[model samples]
Target: MSNFLSGISITLSAIALAVSGWTAYQLSQLNLLIDQQQNTITEQQNTNTQQQDKITQLTQKIEQNKALISSDTTQQLNSVSTTSKAQNNVIQPGQFVRQGFDNKIKIELQSVKRIQNPDSEEKNVVVVQMRIRRIVPKGKVDAISLNQSRGRNPETSEVYRTIQNKSTSFTYINDLPQDSWGNAYFWLKVPEGINVIDIVIPETAIFEAVPISS
Candidate 1:
């Protein structure tokens, strides 16, 4: 009886040990599966972040494009309005127009002429002459500022400003003494085929449909 009981006890102990080893193996496999799942989740989150960044960049580019379009349209409209107003207030060449500032000073457009270049016969030059005189002797005022002189093609409505160089010329009376006369000349270059152009002195005067002749 004692021998039989020892055999049974040994068999039971072996079975218990085998069961514990199997349970440990299963637990290790479960831990490995959990680790793999966590890694997959992290990779997916990174991919989502990259996609969101791309979307943000695209949205900004779209907004910038819209703003540029709006700005360009506004500029075009303003240009057209300026061209139309100049066309309506046209003056003949060689005709004089008087302009006064605050009853203190007076200015006159004396004459305008288109002449061939003395040195370069191929290029044409437009000349404008003006005279300035003071109305008030004791009045203290700043000198008149001539900002820009521009030429516009009638057919195309293209405007050309004076180029500052040796070939182009600009002379103006900055300050005039009381009862004294001052003279100024402005010269500009024009294309050969553009015979009719509008001369514009912003906020001052417009010489409309001025003919260009040799």
Candidate 2:
């Protein structure tokens, strides 16, 4: 009986040791599973953070693009407005017009002849063949004789038999030569409100200023 009791005690001890070992192996497996789960959560969180950062960057880029577009649109609008204003301020002719900048009229005289008045021996009137080269719009033109000695009516542009009637504002034109071009001369005049900065006449008239010989 004593030996049998001792054998039973040894068997019970072996069974307890087996149970403890099995429990320890199960605990280790659970710990490994928990660690895996934690790692998966950490990876998901990192992915989400990266995605948010990208979204923020994209949003900033969109805002910058919008701002640039707005600025360009504003500039284009301003340019159009300025161009429109300039066009509206333009002036036309055949009416009263003002001359801006250094505007001038040019007239060319083709055939100039000295006409001696039979009644007046000392005084002579000049006839010029003239043509219009260029004139500002709304400008007026009439024949003018270049003798201050003759009587002149500034309003009617008429000449009378007086010593002061020699000078004239009107120009005379004659037919060109047979081989020449059309026969016509020009006279230059400026309209009211427009200024005659300068008058350029061709060198076809006698007693006119001579150009430098080139």
Candidate 3:
């Protein structure tokens, strides 16, 4: 009976040893899997951070480009407006001319042979021998004759011409003919409130006129 009991005890000890070994092996494998999962999660987080940084940088660059384009467009528009204003400075005859405030009126005369110097304090007005340039659509000859016979307001009135008469003390000489070079004359009266004289004309309106004397 003692021999039989000893054999049974030995057999139970061997079975317990095998079970302990298997449990240790399973614990080791579980630790390895946990470590690998942690490493993968860390790597994914780093990749996401890098992608976010790149997107922020790209957005900043796009904003800067838009600002540059807006600045360039504004500068170009200002340049064009300044050039247009500079060109509007010439006055002709027989056309509706406006210069200063009050929108004064005048009659334009062409082919002026002479301008008589008036004995007045104003140095702008002078009598001139002028011919008709362009008759207004519904205007009368008597209304246009005022330009040849009488003087207009000095503040807004101006006479554009090319002939320089040094012999007489005229402010300017009228020598441009209406039919020559598709040119027309403009005459305007000075307003009651203003005390300055200036002229303005579009560059595309007329090319140049012929000599009035010839």
Q: Per-residue lDDT for 100-162 in model 2, tens only?
A: 112323334333333444566522433334333233343433332333222233444443332
Off by over 4 Å in 1: 1-94, 100-105, 136-140, 145-147, 165-174
Per-candidate Cα lDDT values, in order, are 0.67, 0.44, 0.40
Per-residue lDDT of model 1, residues 1-214, tens digit only: 9999999999999999999999999999999999999999999999998999999999999999999999999999989997765554344433545555555655566555566776687666766666667777555545454536688898899876664552213332235766677775567777677767777764455666765544
Candidate 2 segments exceeding 4 Å error: 92-214
lDDT by residue for model 3 (53-148), tens:
998999989989999999998899889887654433322454333221111122233332222223344333222332323312222222211222
- Per-candidate RMSD, Å: 15.1, 17.1, 12.2
Worst 10 residues of 3 by lDDT: 98-107
Q: How far is candidate 2 from the true structure (C-alpha RMSD, Å)?
A: 17.1
User: Which candidate comes out best when scored by TM-score?
Assistant: 3
Which has the higher lDDT value, candidate number 1 or candidate number 2?
A: 1
Listed in order, each prediction's TM-score against the native is 0.43, 0.43, 0.43
